[model samples]
Target chain A: MPNPTAAMLVIGDEILSGRTRDANMHHLAGRLTEHGIDLKEVRVVADDPRAIQEAVKALAGAYDHLFTSGGIGPTHDDITAENVAAAFGLPIGVRDDARAILEAHYEKQGLEINEARLRMARVPEGATLIDNPVSGAPGFTLENVHVMAGVPKIFEAMVEGLLPTLTGGQPVVSQTLRVERGEGDIAGPLGALAERYDALSFGSYPFIVNGRFGVNVVIRGQDEAEVTRAMQDLEKAFPA
Target chain B: MPNPTAAMLVIGDEILSGRTRDANMHHLAGRLTEHGIDLKEVRVVADDPRAIQEAVKALAGAYDHLFTSGGIGPTHDDITAENVAAAFGLPIGVRDDARAILEAHYEKQGLEINEARLRMARVPEGATLIDNPVSGAPGFTLENVHVMAGVPKIFEAMVEGLLPTLTGGQPVVSQTLRVERGEGDIAGPLGALAERYDALSFGSYPFIVNGRFGVNVVIRGQDEAEVTRAMQDLEKAFPA
Candidate 1:
């Protein structure tokens, strides 16, 4: 069977405005790939509520899983959690369970939970909280959408915890062979080989090293033995 | 009016599968910002024809311009040119002008243009070719969608050449200030300040430096005087 598909909705103005280079998409894509979940599409939208809700509705409805990163902070600009709830037409407020988690977490640090801090405890009705070990505020999951924080370290930690619980297909394995010749010379053979294999995906990434054009032919498949065989086949077909 | 709203469609499997971190989006976002283009959204889709066509239609229609990177190469995976033509219901074939340019480039390097190399010369009907100084293959502009190469240097070169011919609005300005306090403590005052200076967008990016939580508050606006005033107002309001 094919791998379970996933899509990501990055909710932020920072990325679109060129204020911050998005580190979460690459990290999430890598983690999902390892967990055997095929991340198919990723959309980076602004902090606008309409944009967030529209993306949430579209991506969540289209893919098996929809992951979102950013705008889950205590600040005013952080409006993802509420907008996500609105997208699903659910009631959102500070839940007792989430509040307790924040209270205990803040009590340990001898810091009182202010209104801003209390904002993080807000959860939509019928949503499961995703643990954020890096910080006190927990991310939440509503339907097929997983809403996580924008911070890199916190996002990574949340993903590490969340990925294991997801149902994934066979772990894909990939092998690459670097050909010193230009991609134009290798396209014919590579295309023929790809057609022959049919199941494995062949990606040709070109590079220029020492003023010489070359291509890195990456063969990816669920079966490791098949990937190895394909690599061997590639080497034999190219002959250096 | 809104800095000529723009969106990006990144076409590749490398980004989605997590093998390659996309440098193009960040580069494009920064360049567009400098060129006074408000990049509102960015979508990264696979090499699938349906996905590419769907994104092209959606983004191109919604935004003033849609910039695409990748899938314009000499390999079999390079299917963007033909698919883009199909999206607009336009016929695509190798044009003489593009063929002449590629032929001259390859000839200068003592290389013959093969069938695979010749594929790069294919242009959609009624499209203008975007020059690619880094390589022989040229990117093209079909209506508002600008198709560029995937390679970082080549993509950058295409963008540099393309940006000049496009219309732009006022260049956006930004100022950032680092505060050595948790976002929770700063949220209330920051929110109030944001309400006062409605024209400027304030983004609070949190970080942990030496076990202490802090936020880098970035203030951005098209008006330089307004951005500066807002920054000064922020400093005065926070007083730290």
Candidate 2:
């Protein structure tokens, strides 16, 4: 069976403004890959409601799952949850269950559940909560879209808890054979090998070692047997 | 006037598959920000022709400038050049000017300008070349889109050469005030300050230090005076 496809939507102005280097996309990409989910595309947009809603609608409709990071905190910029809810035309407000989670956590810490703090409890109707083990706030899952915090620690934790619940196909496997030759020298045989193995995908990356650049040709596919066979052929084509 | 808007398209299967971590997006974001060009959106798509072409057409049309990285090399997987041309209804082949540059580079390196190597010389019709100082292969610019190498060093060089040619608006000025309080505590006043300054943008990021998390509120705008005034107001609201 084909792998379940996914897309990521990263919403933040700080990222686009170059103040914060986005760590979530790479982290999510690695996690999703291991879980047998194919991450097809990623879109990073600024902190505008319309922009967020539009991206949510488009990505949610296109992929099997759409995971979003950032803009779910308790600040003026934390507009992702509401915008996501708006995208699906769902009514959103402070839900009793979410409020209960925040209330219990705040009570344990001897802190007041102020209005701004309570903003974290605002979830769309009919959305289930994704536990944030690192912090008190909870993320939400509405339809196939998962909304999580922007913080790396919290986002990673949410993904770990979330992936096991979803169905995924066979995890893709890859093998790389380093050729101590220029990409130009490797391209001909590699291209021919790619054509022979239509089930696999090839990627040629050039890198420098001891001041001499060489190509690392990688073979990837869902079937491990096919991947191994292709790797064997690639090694034969460019014998070290 | 507003800054010239821009978007980035990252074309690579390796990045989407998590075999490679993308450094170009963050690097491009920093460069575009410093150049006074507003980066509004960024999309990372797999190395598929339809995916590449669709993303190219959408981003290039929506933004004033579109910068693409990856898929221009001497490999079967490097299909970005032709796909981008197809998106614009332009014919593509090995143009004389691009071919001459490749030949000269190869002659200097004492390497034969073989067919695979010559693939780097393919240029779309009417597109101008963007110099790749780090490597011999040249990138190209068609309409508002600038296609460049995926390698970090080569992409950086191409961006450096390309930025000086395009017109940019006033450089965005920013100020950050760190508060040793939770984002919930900081949100009310920060949201109010954000409302007071209609032209500026506010971003509140929560960070951990010594086992305690604090909020760092960033204020950004094109006008230095307005940004400074807003910063002053923010400091007054959260006096240390």
Candidate 3:
């Protein structure tokens, strides 16, 4: 099977405002990787409907799966559901199934579900609900777009519930070798090694550790033996 | 004026692969806030030219300023200059001024200015060069799109060089009050305070410290006195 490509759309002005350091992206990245889904792109847009629609359409068309976070709240800024509906050209209303889920969820908590909270039941038409175990609001999957909550806990729960249903490929395994050397000095050898191991992806991340330059050489691939061989060759080329 | 809206496009597959935890977004967010520029969006794209072009055109048109990082190196995957040029419908080539800068830089380093190395000198037509003190490879300013380096050190240097040249509004000042309370408990009062201060932006960040729920109430505005007053009010409302 071809690579399972994925894209993430993070919808919230709060993230861009630096008010919130998003944990969902990291969570999804790791999970998707383990599921053999290569997350190709990540776009963090505001709560604007047009922006959301444009991003949803563009990303959903390009990638095999599109994961969206945020803007599924009670406030006016919560426009992802409506915009996503428009993107897929689907009519949106209070989904009976989602309503049932939310009602049951609230009933268990003995909480009064008012109009403000009931707004969470609204979902795009003909969409399968992605269960939110932590929150009452149900995320929906429409044409490969998985819309989840902005809150990390809720988003995580939704992902956990959703992942088991999807088909996945052999997960990419990776190992890192830390070298106490500058990137410029190691760039030539690293480039050659990357060219040799065309199947595996290699990355050289440079960092300063206590005023000393160091590079972390990462080797990633689906084949564990091939990745190990490449790592061995890399170690031989640049012995610690 | 008009909140000085801006957007950031991070062009790299490394970030999505979790090869690197991003420092650019946080640094840029802080800088933009200090410059009174409200960053409305942030997109992380792969090294694909089409993705780069699409994101640049959309964001540049929507925002007052658009900042891009990565995909402008000497490597084959570094197509940011060409993509950015395509976004603006401008021809990309090695400009004389940029070539001169690179030539001088190379001469000082006693390095050969090959076709591969000269790739760094290529800039979109009708663009101004951004100074890079840390690295010889200079970033460029094309219209409102600020093409910056991927390396954190170089990116930060470019930002420092560019910040003073741009027309900045009154710096946004922020005051944070850490209260020993859960967000649910403080949500009501925080919402009221947010309404009371129409000129300011307010947000509640909730975190757990030592198994206790704690909330940090942030009040941000241009007026120092007003922000101080708000902080004083918060202190009075929730003493210590």
- Sort order, DockQ high to low: 1, 2, 3
Off by over 4 Å in 2: A209-211
**TM-score of the B chain in each candidate versus the native B chain:** 0.98, 0.97, 0.96
Q: What part of the reference interface contacts, as a 0 to 1 fraction, does candidate 2 reproduce?
A: 0.80
Question: Can you tell me which runs of candidate 1 are displaced by over 4 Å?
Answer: none
- The alpha-carbon deviation from the true structure for residue A112 of candidate 2, after best TM-score superposition, in angstroms, is 1.0
Q: Each predicted model: what fraction of the native A–B Cα contacts (within 8 Å) does it retain?
A: 0.83, 0.80, 0.36
- Candidate 2 global CA lDDT score: 0.91
lDDT for each residue of candidate 2 in A1-240, tens digit (9 for 90 to 100):
789999999999999988999999989988888889999999999999999999999999999999999989989889999999999999999999999999898788788899898999999999999998777899999999999999888899999989899998888898999888888888888899999999998899987666577888999998899999899888888899
> What is the Cα-based lDDT of residue A204 in candidate 2?
97
- Judging by TM-score against the true structure, name the best candidate: 1
Candidate 2: residue A233 lDDT (0-100): 86
Q: Clashing residue pairs in candidate 2, if any?
A: none
**Cα misplacement distance, residue B205 of candidate 1 (Å):** 0.7
Ranking by lDDT: 1, 2, 3
The first chain of model 3 has a TM-score of 0.97
Report the lDDT tens digits of candidate 3 across residue range A1-240: 766899999987667766677778878988888888899999888667888998999999999999999878654446788899999899999978888887797788676666656678898888989887766678999989999988777789999999888888889899889988655556667778889899987866666666565777888899999999999998998899
Candidates, DockQ:
0.88, 0.85, 0.35
Q: What DockQ number belongs to candidate 2?
A: 0.85
* Residue-by-residue lDDT tens digits, candidate 2, B154-219: 898899999999998888889999999888888888898899898998889998777677888899
CA lDDT scores, all candidates in order: 0.93, 0.91, 0.82
